[model samples]
Target: MKNVIITGTSRGIGLELVKCFAEAGHQVLALSRNSQPVSDLNLKQVTALSFNLAEATDFETVKAYVNTHWKQVDLLIHNAGALVNKPFSELTPADFQNVYTTNVFGVAELTRVLLPNMVKGSHMVTISSMGGIQGSMKFPGLAAYSSSKGAVITLSELLAEEYKDSGIAFNVLALGAVQTEMLEEAFPGYEAPTTAAGMASYIFNFSLTGSTFYNGKVLQVSSSTP
Candidate 1:
């Protein structure tokens, strides 16, 4: 079984992703701001830690865990995201900073620290949004959230190119409206075609084999828009 690291595992898709990996018998490191939900599951071969993307020291916790327990990381899924649903005129500099810190900066910091534990055939999958896609449908209240998602897409593509020879693959999934708490926060009462568990299953499968077929690519995994 592979050693996998998944962030944002307290609820919604992240939580389901943890169940999927654990059921498949892979060693999992589940990270989130609130660790109780995952900890309650008490699944074997799963370690849940309270991790905050905005906190600088949390990245070190992951690095230390890998060094102490699992010497190598087979997959890293950057699934934690922050959202701010406010009009563009009301958006402040701090708003953008907070969103970027969780979505973009955190992804980079965690990946940088974990690179040493990752070897050939390792995969890094980042969960983005369809709103991040250029030329796609745009919404008004997501200026900070959408823009931050867009930034990480480019970041993944750049990393994939830089590490082409290292056998590490980076890819982004621009997901559409999924029935998640975050989606409810963005667009209340709107129903999504996909469920968290459904999307999680897809991601679990992709994390295991997507590196062989694609890298530096952004797949638009959506049937509806915001």
Candidate 2:
């Protein structure tokens, strides 16, 4: 019954999240660079858009959709992410820029554009990574990706405090390894303890109810250590 917005819905966890919300009978706005996959699903009450988080024009499209269609957004999930797996010495400035653009900057810009449509009690759930956690564990090749994730964690905290009186909640979920295409591309041959559908289900439930107990908090949803 709620109007929900989910980004990165082309494949992996994002794709599963779209299914979870649609099957639950929620009105879903699924955004991704390649929207055809979600378009092919043809789920009732689901609208898939070819959206690029890194592009400012796409945000305008989302604003138009929200203004024209949904009166309010009950939940916004920042599930889109970009990763570059290369040694620090080989990493270029453009590498960091691209990762930050999609992961950090995009999340901020999209939230800004959607803020007016999100009423009191709305929840903004950002999908972060355990690698982003300070003093947890560090990997050599994830300098840009992990740093961008960390930036968002702080950004959510700041937003939660800034918008405390507004009644909107901002929280983060720092996830462990999941068996996703992104994982395969980053760390080949590694088997994860969780699946995309499993994580999606967890996130779906949390988005519905987590605001009651948490705001400006980062829950480390990991069964295994990184």
Candidate 3:
């Protein structure tokens, strides 16, 4: 069984992912600002860690814990993100910084700290959004969120290329609208075609097979065909 580390495990897709991985017999480290929900699951082989991804300093605790317990992580999934839905004209500099701190900087910083624990054949996956990719439907109020996700995709590509010879794979999954609390907040009264559990299952399977068949690629997951 692989040792997996996933961020944003308090609710929605992140919580579902924790369930999927734990059910698959993997040792999972679930990180979230409020880890009580994950802890309440009481699943075997699952450990809950609390930390705010938007705060860079909070990762020191994670680094310390990982360094003490885990020798290596087989799978690392960056699923935590911040969405600030505001028109460009109304968006402030703080809005971009806040979004990027969680969506992009957090991923980079965590990976950097955990690099030593990622051996050959390990995999890193970042969750992006369809809105971040070119030609995807762009909602006017999601500039900060979309731009940060776009940067995440680019960062994954660069890391993939950098680690190509080391046997470590990096990839991004650009997801379509999924039914989650975050989505409801972004688009009130609108229903998404995909559910968190469904997407979580897909992500769990991909984390297992993706490193072997794909590397440095962005795969889009959605129920709606375009």
- Candidate 1 residue spans exceeding 4 A from truth: none
Over 7-37, each residue of candidate 2 has an lDDT whose tens digit, in order, gives: 9999999999999999999999999999999
The per-residue C-alpha lDDT of model 2 at residue 159 equals 96
Q: In model 2, where do residues sit more than 4 Å from their true spots?
A: none
- Cα deviation of 75, candidate 3, in Å: 0.5
Clash list (residue pairs), candidate 1? none
Model 2: number of clashes? 0
lDDT of 3 by residue, 171-216 (tens): 9999988999999878887788889999999999999999999999
Which residue ranges in model 3 land beyond 4 Å of their true spot?
Answer: none
Q: Which 10 consecutive residues of model 1 have the lowest summed lDDT? A: 53-62
Can you give the TM-score per candidate against the true fold?
Answer: 0.99, 0.99, 0.97
Cα lDDT tens digits, model 1, 130-185, are: 99999999998999999889999999999999999999999999999999999999
Model 2, position 83: C-alpha lDDT score: 95
